[model samples]
Target: MAEEDEGPQKAVADPETYRESLDAWMKMQMPAAEDLRVHAVDMPRATGFSNETVFFSATWSQAGEQTTHRYVARIEPPDGGLFPIQTRECEISCELQHRIMSAIKDSGVAPIPELLPFEPDTGVLGRPFFVMEFIEGLVPADVPRYTQAGFLVDDATPADRERMVRDAVETMGALAGLDWRTMGLDWLDVKAKGQPSLQDQIELYRDYVDRELSGREHPILSASLDWLDANAPSAPVGISWGDSRLGNMIWKNYRCASVCDWEAVSLCPPEADIGWFVMFDRMSYDDFDVPRLEGFPTREEQVAIWEAKSGRTVGHTIDYWEIFGAMRFDAIMIKLGDRMARAGIVPAEPGISIDNGTTDGLGRLLERQGVSL
Candidate 1:
């Protein structure tokens, strides 16, 4: 796998270094006489552009008893990250972790790993990182694409694959139905410069293109943003899982066991999330040559389940939202590609850009909208 081959070489911290730092921190948290030893401190090959996740096992002795636990540490990029802190309106990563976990508490929509602690002081490690219980389940890989190579397609029965898709969409629907303000998630409602949250996202992406990818011309993204501005939907506002997709979920027993990665949680139209989820699925097949798992819900079936569970119609705006989804991916890939190039992961100019698939896919959608890129 590309991730397995490249991840270890590109990792920012060594396993030995991680264990030393984590053990020291854990020892301080335990009783004075208690012993805290960390082992199996390996960064998962699933590290992505946004955050670094490392898994480890810890054994501690306290009051004549010893216990061992598996945990995950999600760390912010020590240097500049793909999503820069300056571009965001929320607090730092640690604070955001607390806020998101607090909002979803007792919601009963799906299981989430228990958030342990947010270490602000970088003295223990080079950068602040938060710990959570390590969820044990099947997480679809992205680099090779799950459809192309993963336990989901390689091992699971067709029925289980179908259940995975349906349950994942249902989880999204439950989230869209959530009352953010009632759940005390109003903190995610940042100042949108007097514009609706959806509009704010459009502007934000456009700004990212201009400032983050200066001297670059992304015709498809530019066209999609313009179309969004012209055809802004009047859909009801709701919570949007910014990175909504089946890949972000941990599956066990053919159902979504846990939904993780709330970095892009926001107040936006419900369609925004559905669009993202749909486009990601579409890309897996259309761009990567990865076939959709048999028995999974079709696009129409997914929408039907979403409407039933969310208790709202996507109406005629579903197409528009999907286009927005493709565009959003393109915008983020602009940064992702640049990051990889700077790190020498890939050449400065590849035949097809890192975001080529998403950009081309969005172009086809634009033609349907009578817009040219």
Candidate 2:
């Protein structure tokens, strides 16, 4: 929750100003006015932060008829972090989107919307923003505060929920199995200096955690770091979705249409992803009484499928990352909670929701270590 004592370049751009910039980008990108027609452009009321995402309706009128279109726009935030949750810059995010969609093009992976266009320069949208064809239908698991309100109360049928979960696992498995090294990305430079290998990634994240939370100390976090260092998997890192979880993949018609927010897709061990996934499910203690998810895959079934394809085994060290994952999410939640209290950006949360979420996550982590939360 503490502000960075040391500094990195920070930029703050207002939403309204950002939108105007994006609209200008649309105009420029589609300079052929006759061919391009935009009907309506709108953003969500309560903005979400996965990226500076906004929704817009585009109507294309060519020659005689008008065709309606909808799109989701995402841009980099004004303030950047040394090693923050936003993950990658526009370059990596765009590249991942391209590659993943390419892989799933002909498959039953549910057609992902195509990227209409993007501009890397901050000149447009005050930062990089990309527009993609927006797919219709409910996300299935959402706050359901807006366009998706009706489905929120549906009490999803068992068959539909199972299909959605299976689809998610299949899509992710396909992605992790992808051969990303052939993308000529060996020449692609990562901003983090030491990223020639997985060890570099592990060490970098560990160091960042230590430095960022210099004043705060968690014994489990320290233990997790040591455990990972001592047991680095020798297998070459594959495409690991840095933030692979059910929440990230939304269901459309009992299928996952969008596998998104690829700002963190990178080379990492298959176990790295499975461990993260397993721990995420474990963190939720996702047994019963969960609102958004009715019932989903057990960690065993998901791991079995991934293992059958990858031929890898998960061990003790990964248990640490799972704990660390909880720690990472916990830290974020704590920061959000603090901001809610200090700045009153949303509702000055009296620290209720995450208080229990963190407690549960910690309990899961401690259980892994044969301790109690």
Error of model 1, residue 289, in angstroms: 3.7
lDDT of 2 by residue, 1-373 (tens): 3544533323224556545655566667666544554445565543223356677665555668766667787655433311233234323354345444544453443356777655566545545556777876555343432113345336566667567667766666666565545543442224444245566556656655565445665545555556556655566666666667666765667777777666555555545666666666664445333444455557677776666655565544556556645644544554445444555565643453245456465555666666532
Q: What's the lDDT for residue 20 in model 1?
A: 87
TM-score of each: 0.88, 0.74
Q: What C-alpha lDDT do the candidate models reach, one value each?
A: 0.75, 0.55
**Model 1 steric clash pairs:** none
- Cand. 1 Cα-lDDT: 0.75
Q: Which candidate number has the best TM-score? A: 1
Collision count of model 2 = 2
Each prediction's RMSD to truth? 5.7, 6.0
Residue-wise lDDT of candidate 1 within 1-373, one digit each (tens)?
Answer: 7633533233346789889888877777655546689999888664346667888998977789988899988876644344323125454655575457656756766578877667866556656678888878888889778878878777888888888888988888888888766676655655534233777677767776778668767677788889999999777667787778888988888788888877676677877888888788788877777567787678888888888888888867889889988777777677777777777787878723445777788899899989965
Each candidate's number of clashing pairs is 0, 2
Candidate 1 is scored at a TM of 0.88
Model 2 TM-score? 0.74
